[model samples]
Target: MMINSDNLCMSCMKDIGTEKQCPYCGFHADSKQIEPYLPIRTVLGNRYLVGKLLEYNGDGATYMGLDLSTRESVNIREFFPENIAQRDPKTLGVFVMPEKETIYNECLQSFTEMWRKLMRLSGLSALIKVRDILEGNGTCYAITENIDGITLREYLLRNNVGYISWEKARPLLMPVLSTLGTLHASGIIHRGISPSTLVVAPDGKIRITGFSISPVRSARSELKCQLYNGYAAFEQYGFEGRQGTWTDIYGFGAVLYRTLIGTDPIDATERVTNDRLMVPGKFAEQLPAYVINGLVNALQIMPEDRTRTVEELRAELSASPSAVAGTGVEYEPVVPVTVKKPVAQRIVDEEDEEDYTYNKREAAKKRHNRSSAVIAVCAIIIVLAIAFLVLWQTGVIKIDNDTTTTAAAETVEVPNFVGKPYSEIVDNTYNTKNFTFEKNEVYNSTVEEGYVISQSVDVNKKVPVGTTIRLEVSKGKESIVFPTGGIIGTKYEDAQKYLTRLGFKVEKSIKLNLDNEIPDTVQGFSLEEGVSYEKGTTVFLFVWSEPETTAPEEEPTSEDETTLDDIVDDTIDKIINFGRGN
Candidate 1:
């Protein structure tokens, strides 16, 4: 293998001459990387040149990497489950413990599957894009795009007020709520939703990242759990509790609370023992009534009593309350309403206490009238109750405890949609009448076109009527045509964006610009122009590397020079002055 040392520093991917240390980034090219982590410049999949270890948890380590096929920088997530796995020093492969091999394989599979699903959901507004998935060195790797932004935590700390107003937070948080809803619909629950996991981009939009397998997010699992103190839900702390979308709702509400109230809420574990969180009274004046109400409901200690869905949470936050009724709670009266105070109470003024006279006779008369009306209503209710009891004794009216009330929504069993023709699902009233179907078309070689490949909701599962079931219909084998014109000599960023918008992954390669070519411009594509390829094809884009420039060294001048004798004399004078107490 030939090493290309000219115009490239592997540590920082900067253009520099062959040197041990990278002057641009202070990275040493020949510095020994820590064991268990891949060595600097170690290539994965013969494409990604791995760099420094960015961060790691019990699940795996993330590294800064450059795609050799494309000159773009990317984040490579390697699945090295530290709990049950070890690194082979010589081969740089992960070695699982003798008894934990099955667990390791399962976790690796989970890491792979999660990234694959996230790859399908890449275009979500706030989700971090998963570029590709690879299996190498006895483990799996997920390639995610490097986002240039600070965490929501840092963003909040940088704010002058320490907290954000409801008006400012609504727009920032609503998009994330929408993205979380989409993730839930796709059967992905972000149990670790928090300000730390959320990145605020340069555009001021939030990007959701920090995804891991279920065990890493839950307590008492095989791996070490990484739960955010105040943001984790109560259910996450227990193994028996079933975690779902409601779990993320708790974390989301905590993030919102931190943003709006300017402090971390009580941790769910502590709240269980002593449930009290103090949101400042001033925040009530700053935030809307419904926004606070939504936060309270979402941050409920109990899962069943909490806001169960993202749509419900969003609606609640937006002043449209959709309260979930628990065992004894009634849903109708939960909507907050403003009421006018009585005229007598309204008339009280502290400053004008001596000016107004108390009307004792009027107040007494009003109380008597209200008591008489209440008595009359009670007499009518008693008479009706007696008549109903008499009729029940004579078997005129029978009580049935098993009867379903109008308030309880009727549930229908979900019908099997797999292997059914898409035409049959839409055109047939029997299938379409019970539920609203959301269709996603994908290419599958085995399944015929126009047939349902799979459904999100399982068959025979009882769900409420009008529940949405996501269906993936087949589109046969994909025949995606690569876009034409204005690609070569254009900026690679723009070209990559265009290609990505067309559902193609861009693999960038750097080429030396011998001619007077524009730096970072798209030189050419590996795929032929106007050619059709399968869906999700990696388009290799060769970009022109920027011309190397060396920094000019300055000549030694009298003003710029600092002599050793001058330093010594200054130190001695300081010592003498200190001794003399001058």
Candidate 2:
């Protein structure tokens, strides 16, 4: 069966000719998209062919797209903060209210900058890969690889128990944890890490999607917040709350709670008022003690009380009663204790009040009797001892002495610190007094700055308490003198690779050319060639492109443009497409 690439279905990207309904995906081709969303088959960057709108949030809209160059499917994310920005149907460009222009532009930059960082940090197994970023239509677009899988929500629903055991979930979630730690190190915090943002592939691996700017995920920003009730941290609910790694920790803990308890935890706001979210006794019994403790601490309502780092959360999960005995931190397992009476219960009924009074009197009487008995027994024992002592004074008693022994010093295993952020570990080691860290700074190409490159003590080696472990922290890659004259006239692709290889962030912008010149070649650069620049410096390249040719214009109807109301309503229902893509 032959398929026409030009006549592809917007819903599934499959070929469907002349039929109003797609046979493959069961999508009605004639069904119109809502206002403010990209129209079906809209082309972007002269390469990506945007299909149906997949999902939208406070930050932007995501669409199913096809990479025209490769004919492969991709996910396109557009920056369109609804609360502060509006769309011009005539020009397909976004405009903001004059007063909110600054905030809108700031958030837009944040959206693009976050994606740029993610683009550089791609290839982590637990994270969706960001492929390319381009600017147009008064906004930014991030192109990411599409995942063929279902959301974690659906995955849990498909399971018989609607949950998984700790053993089954540990391997699946550890990658996400590690990836989060890396993201935090890179100054990126994913405030939205709920089940809907997590995708489970056919291989049974979970990958995180739905990345957005801070304002979109937090409350009281210029944009409307799209926070997951049970997954969002308490700090995200208020503008004055300071958020850090702990914000993501709360979401991560909520995810684990859902994965193990077979239900969503109570919303953070509700928990703040009336905290009734606890793991069921049945599920708690099924999980490891350390795991339950880890979940509780990570899901604390207050950020100060919550697990502050992925490393700490992992430690809690891996610890045992014996392992943490002398670590100064107690990991108490959750047990369902039955209390005969409520600690704060009040007796309102006459009969209940009378019974309580009677019980109190009975308890006092029993205490008095026990004290009298103890005192009488002690007097009799003292009298007997006095008589015996008097006899012993006459040399009637003899005693034997035995040798005493001294206990050995306590020892603890040295923890692995290589490749960890030195700042995170220093405080713990110093406070615990188990080991002392002697820090040294050095330049390294492989290790990230502020991270431990090497440690003097071997990991897992049993050492006595107060051992001084020398650590060398990375100062990041050493600065290098820019190479002379090799970056000017090369092709854009070649130049990008060259600049990136020399430790610089390369950004390319298309320069339209009417004069006969090489297309896709570098026309100019933002930085001078022979100057010393620090690693990770952004270098912009002006690339020549073919002159624009006039094409038949398509008028955008009311249904083709997305309104603020459309985005607001769509956000509430966007979870339906969580399994679709980013």
Candidate 3:
């Protein structure tokens, strides 16, 4: 329950019905951040209290809100497609631009489908949680549980001071990789898996945050999706490119590359022209060869050459001696031969605050070390002279020394637990006798519903034989049920949103205007919108048709276009008539 207190300061999630002032920061709620939209202190859907305008990502304007029912802080993401549609200040109706009406409706449908998909994925723990989806201010609001953690970018900068060793990074990456693998297998691609999107929770857990249907993608019928230059894959840039699971893999690889190297790799667009990306091993020899190879393979510019799946990438990243041998890299379980260099301390200007006493202290310590070395040398010489004198006086010397030691415990090999059944592993005879196991059930895309997807302990590792290992078991894909609610007569957008919000999938079609009916209004539904159905039941919606407008009659300005050809044809006709008369 480590909530990100950074965004929560604007309002007390615990005190949902409190005063207008922000409980933590004491900032007035009347601060109007964005314009041409809902003003400050506007309570959306009558329950979530709007606090502050968090950000204006390309797709929507996000607001930190408080849910009264749960009394928890939540991020309310509004589907404000500012490019194609806008909210009318006076009436508060979402009006699509006259030219972009068709695309607007399509984008709206896509938004609905995206939220529905998210609702279906509650089994995936690392995926951001969605509390509720509601219509507000003539647009849709997706309420997600607020996460409390620093971004991976912040963690890298603050904790690592720039970059970290592979040993430290391996553990940090496993949880995210496991979650992302399930997402990919469930036919979901993050599309945006940059350092900023990953949160390192206060409890040292990884929570992938910032889910936005990037509005700048050109490949699909939908207009545009948000695209990051350095992080986006090659296919995501244009309509001709084929985007798939590999698309997200590229972004994930880019983030991995960026974090490991402390710098952004070449942008996908630029990589096509000239790729000079230095491998991790090339830049840092101390890193494991397998990890270096894994990173390099993941960052391949072409999807065909790239690590095609999350499992493939994970296997490479978690490569053992045999795994590295399969990849043609020399396998050695010992420390790297290259000497690792310590991170250099930053140089400061003479007048800089960090320069004053620290420099003096460092210099004094070096001088003291030199003086101590000289004193020690003199003392050693005097001791040697005294020892020689004693030996001469005694004419003979005798010495004796004795040592005692104890034998160490013999170590035994750890067992392989990959793809093991959770039920059997938990209450198994061998499991109880030799080792202890901790099991967690999570949604797995490739692994069977009851089998283990991953284990914390390495297989065949000799560690006093009975080492306790933590295992993550798969529950398969979680089923989503369409919720039932009253939506007999609502606005077409409202109806689609209503059905969608209630977990009932919707398919809409406008009826032909044989009777000159109104357009974009909920005319009828194939099934009763009030009645609940099983999850993923698509309810076809019939919208009222708009009267077709005839194009204005064009002026007769085309008379001269047939001039030369018409005159020639007339002459030929006259000759033919003369010949017939003769």
Work out the TM-score per prediction: 0.54, 0.56, 0.52
Error of 2 at 4 (Å): 6.0
Model 3 lDDT tens row, 241-302 = 56666777777778777777787777776777776666544445576666666666666666
lDDT of 2 by residue, 274-380 (tens): 77786676776677656766777788777755667888777777776565343333222343211121111122221333222124455457759989999999999
Q: Model 2 Cα RMSD, Å? A: 32.7
Per-residue lDDT for 1-582 in model 1, tens only? 434534566555676676767888776565445556788878898888788776665588888888777677789999987658888878998899889988888988888888899999999989999989999789999999888789998999999877888878989989999999999998899888888899998899999999989898886577756677789888987734579888998899999999988888788877876766755667755565566667777787777556678887777676532322211222122222111111111122223432223355665688699899999999999999999999999999999989957766657667557766677566433245457989999888567677788999987687886889999998977778887888998999999999988878999999987776789998889888789887788999999998766689989999989999999999999999999999
- Which residue ranges in model 2 land beyond 4 Å of their true spot? 1-4, 324-582
RMSD of each: 31.7, 32.7, 32.6
Ranking by TM-score: 2, 1, 3
RMSD of 1: 31.7
> Which residue ranges in model 3 land beyond 4 Å of their true spot?
1-28, 214-224, 280-283, 330-582
Q: What lDDT would each prediction earn against the true structure?
A: 0.78, 0.78, 0.65
Name every residue pair that clashes in candidate 1: 69-508, 70-508, 70-509, 71-508
What is the model-wide C-alpha lDDT for candidate 3?
0.65
